[model samples]
Target chain A: MEGDIASIGAGLAAIGSGIAAIGVGNVAGNYLAGALRNPSAAASQTATLFIGLAFAEALGIFSFLVALLLKFA
Target chain B: MATDTHETVVSACLDSHGGAIGMPQLCGEWIPHQIFWLLVALAATFFVMSRIALPRIAAVLAERSGTITNDLAAAEELKNKAAEAEAAYDKALVDARAQAQQIVAEAKAEIQAELDVELAKADAQIAEKAAESEKAIAEIRDGAVKSVTDVAKATTKELVAAMGGTADAKTITAAVTARMKG
Candidate 1:
């Protein structure tokens, strides 16, 4: 029963990471669909896609930090 | 010291969410710092994208449009030049045809004048030859008439002697002259 809340938080954090994965997949899938339609414009939009992926990944990282701190500290 | 502060501030709100007090992200002490950094990141991203990247994209689009317009103008100019050249060629062709017709007319007139002169010379030669032939025919007729008169006078005097008639020269001449006259 030690750090039971922390353990659940870690599980939730894992789910958060999964949500981030879904977000990343959505951004990449949509970009790929559009890129296939017009390959000439794909290069210009690549940086924006990377920025979106990074922001979505940041949320998962914050959730992981919270779970780790709750478990260890 | 940092862990103690984190535990103290987060413990107030942690139990309500079924979380432990040791989560640094939930600590009141870290709130301001995280918010400050997040705002900074957001503002920096906004400024960089709006001021640098967006303007660069706009400039690229504008340059493409300008190139398209210039190419269209150049094509139009070439088309106009082609039209002008065609018109010039047509004008030159028409002028050449007119000049050729004028040359042909002048040559025909010159040839006709020469032919007329030759025809006049031929007619004059024909008329002169006809006059000479008529003069020669008149001289031949006059010589034949004089020879016949002399032969008739001699024959009449011979015929008078052969008939046992005495021939007087004066009478025989008178008779032959009268017959010739009749």
Candidate 2:
């Protein structure tokens, strides 16, 4: 109760990081599904899969960064 | 007075305890500093990536694809060569078989001609032997007929003398000849 309202904003921003986790899971899960359906093509698409993971994880990192900024910037 | 004294003693952005008075990230005083460093870092990353990492990756990919294409071409060529070799082998086999058949036919013809010649020689030899045998049989029959005619003439003369009748040799011969002729 004695803390500033920015701490509340920071806590809310962390929720976005958790939401970003859902996006990352969606990307990985879809890739796995496609890979399992066509294993012969999986080897060629590994690079694309890693790129998707990086893009998904970048958003999660951004949300975590915003949370840090809100908390202690 | 307390707030003014606190702001004067400490800096505008820091508390007396050395903590930030507010969000330092949004402070106008440090915006240029952050912007300049951000640009510098981004430029450095772009230069390294564009000049080194990206070109290496592209070259590796190109080389790998080229190698795969070359290998595929080589495999195709080898397959064609194998087919040609097999065709050549089949042709050679056919030629050899034909030559063998021709040799067999030539040998058969030669053997038949030799057999025909041997058969003709044997026939000629058998015909000569048969003719000689027939001539010998005719001479023996002529000798036997002369002997029989002499024996009958002597017996007829003896019989005439026993009967006390004189029979002439010429008459007896004439009668015997007449009877023998029948």
Candidate 3:
């Protein structure tokens, strides 16, 4: 039962990380499109894109913590 | 009874540790595994952002900046062209004004010349009329004097003829002197 729980946690972590990557890719793609349309506003929109990337990356960090908790705790 | 109950609870807590966890604890503490995982995630995020994401963002930003600069340069060029057009328009306006002034001056000069010519012609006509009037007065005085002298001579001849007679020498001599005087 412990092994099964550990494996499930690892799978969930991997899925979370993959979802985060997809979110980052979506943000980058949208930002690139917007930047192409309005080159002048690129500097202003950069902060928003960074914030979006950070939020998506936090989800991966949460998954990594959960995986560690299940493995060691 | 209380001590036995306390011992049972401690044994239960020990059993929960998964094995013989024999370690002298100074201040009761344990390692936090979640914190370690969070640290690893933070490091990975930093690496990925610095190595992959930042470079991509930088490239996009550079391209955008280049485009903006190009647009600004084009706008500046257009502004310069507009300024040049305005200058040309002003120059044309100045030239037109100068040309109009020159034309007005020339017209005024021509009008003055025409007025001068008309005045001189009027003066010449008045002088000619004055000269013709003086000549006419002189001819009328000469005619009146000739008519008066002819009338006086005819009257004296008629009187001498009327007094004529074949008489003595004195009479004849008197008649001859009278005729000579006439």
Candidate 4:
């Protein structure tokens, strides 16, 4: 039963991580398009883009941690 | 005996396993995996942004900057040219003004010189006319004096001839004296 629960938690974690990744992809795609259109603003926008990517990736990281925790603890 | 003990230990371990088991978890800490994936994603994003996006953007920016600088330099050169042209025009204007003044001065001098020459000529003519008038007056006076002397001499001769016939010395003398006195 514990193993089954752990498996289920791991599966949810994967889904959550996948969803976060999708969000990051969207942000990056939009940033790229905008950068292409207005190259002058790229220097100013790079930091913001990285910050957004970091936040989205943080969520995925949290989900992965939950999966590991459920499995181990 | 060792094989029997190994089997017993394995069975014990399997029996202790939970029924809910579907997958095995490798470790208690998921942070490592999370960090690794996050790093991977960030690296990928940065790579695309730097390699693909940033270089093109920089190139575009550089081109625009170059164009702007070239335009500014051209404008500066044009401005300098215009200023030089203006300076040249001003210099020419000054030269023209000076030349005109010189011409005017020269003309005035020439007019003054002509006037002086005319005045001198008129003065000479007046002096010449005055000398001619004086000469004419002197000649007329001399002619009048000569005519008066000639008339006196002729009258004397006529009187002497008329009183000479059949007259004594005293009578002639008395008659001549009377006539002369009268």
Candidate 5:
């Protein structure tokens, strides 16, 4: 039971990564909906959309890092 | 509350354990390998994205913009054409109106000329009738004067004869004529 705590922590971190994925999906979905509506305006906002995607993906990466930390350090 | 205490205990244990964990990623021998692979993967991704995918995306965007601009230009041309057509239509309407007015004026002038001719003919007929009436009146006056002279002459002869005086026709005519003249 004592040794299993690390694996449980890693599993929770993996769940957090999954939650981050939902956040990333939210950002990407909204961007696509808006982009498809006004393709001309989409070009100007593409950088902003990508920045939002990176921010959400960074959270997932942080979760992955935490999982790695629990497993290895 | 119980979970929070357990999390703190695990955190303290992790702090004490340092790098001594059970995962292969923490092993010293794999560090170089992981770094090398990470670099390779990053380089490949950057090269592909920048050199291939991004350029294709840029081309599609440029084509879309070109299509939009060309369509807008065509719309502008059509709009100008519509305006020109409308102007021509208005000009034609004005010309038609002017032509109609000109035709009406010509008809009026023609009608006026006909009216003037008719009026002149009527005036001529009226003048002829007036002259005929004057001639007729003069004839009637001459006839009435002759009748009156004959009656006066007959009356004078009767009166002279009744008084036992001889009446000469020549003398009576002369006297009556002189009296009338005087």
Candidate 6:
């Protein structure tokens, strides 16, 4: 209660980081399901799976960066 | 320290309590230092990856692909060789079978010719034996006829003698022959 409105905005941005975690989990879970369905095709698609994981994690990192910026800057 | 009024004015970025008056990260004075360090880190990463890591990865990938291609080619060559060997084996088998058949046919023909020669020789021997037997049978038949005529003459002579007739040998023979003719 002693902090400014930017602290509240930082808390909301941290929520965005948590929401981004859901997106990353969805990407990984879908990839695992597809991999289990056709194991033979899974080896060829590992690069694509990694690229999806990086993209999803990068969004979460951006949300975390926004939260940090809101807190400090 | 109380005589330096310029030091108090220059330290406006900090509060009286030694805390930052505003966010230190957004200060203009630190921007150049942050950018310089950022560029240094990026250049170092680029140098390590380009000069060392990327080249090694590329070499490994190239070598692996080359080895795979060579192995595939070798397998293909071996397959062709196996096929060729099988064809040669099949051809040799066929040739051997044909040779065996020809040998069997030649042996059969030789055996048949030898059998025919033996059969002809046996047939000739049989014919010569038959001719000799026929000649012997004709001679025996002639002797039997002479014997029967002689026996009839003797029997008639004895019968005449018993009846007390004094007949001559020539007349008796003539009468026996005449009776035999009847």
lDDT of 1 by residue, B1-182 (tens): 33443434344535544454665565786698899999999999999999999999999999999999999999999999999999999999999999999999999999999999999999999999999998999888888877887788777767777887887888877887788889
TM-score of chain B of 2: 0.46
For model 1, what is the error of residue B84's alpha carbon versus the real structure, in angstroms, after optimal superposition? Answer: 2.2
List the candidates ranked by TM-score, beginning with the highest: 6, 5, 2, 3, 1, 4
Give candidate 6 misplaced runs (Cα > 4 Å): A1-13, A21-73, B1-41, B52-86, B123-182
Local accuracy of candidate 4 as per-residue lDDT tens digits, B35-122: 8999999999999999999999999999999999999999999999999999999999999999999999999999999999999999
Across A1-73, the per-residue lDDT of candidate 6 in tens digits comes to: 3998888888888887788889889988998999999999999998998899898888888877887777876
Residue by residue across B24-121, what tens digits does model 6's lDDT show? 67667777889999999999999999999999999999999999999999999999999999999999999999999999999999999999999999
Task: List, for all models, the DockQ compared with the true complex.
Answer: 0.32, 0.24, 0.03, 0.06, 0.32, 0.26
Candidate ordering by DockQ (highest first) = 1, 5, 6, 2, 4, 3
Residue B166, model 4: lDDT of 45
Per-residue lDDT over B1-182 for candidate 5, one digit per residue giving the tens place of the 0 to 100 score: 33443434343223333423355556666688899999999999999999999999999999999999999999999999999999999999999999999999999999999999999999999999999999999999999999988988888889888999996999989988887778
Best by TM-score: 6
Model 4 lDDT tens row, A1-73:
2457667877787788888889899889999999999999988998999999999899988897787766655
Which of the CAPRI classes, incorrect, acceptable, medium or high, describes model 4? incorrect
- lDDT, residue A69, candidate 5: 82
Query: Whole-model lDDT for model 6 versus the true structure?
Result: 0.86
How far is B15's C-alpha from truth in model 4 (Å)? 28
Better of 5 and 6 by TM-score: 6
Worst 10 residues of 5 chain B by lDDT: B11-20
Name the best candidate (by lDDT).
2
The whole-model lDDT of each prediction reads 0.83, 0.87, 0.74, 0.76, 0.86, 0.86
In model 2, state the lDDT of residue A48.
94
Q: Model 4 segments beyond 4 Å from truth?
A: A1-73, B1-28, B121-182
Q: How many pairs collide in each candidate, listed in order?
A: 0, 0, 0, 4, 0, 0
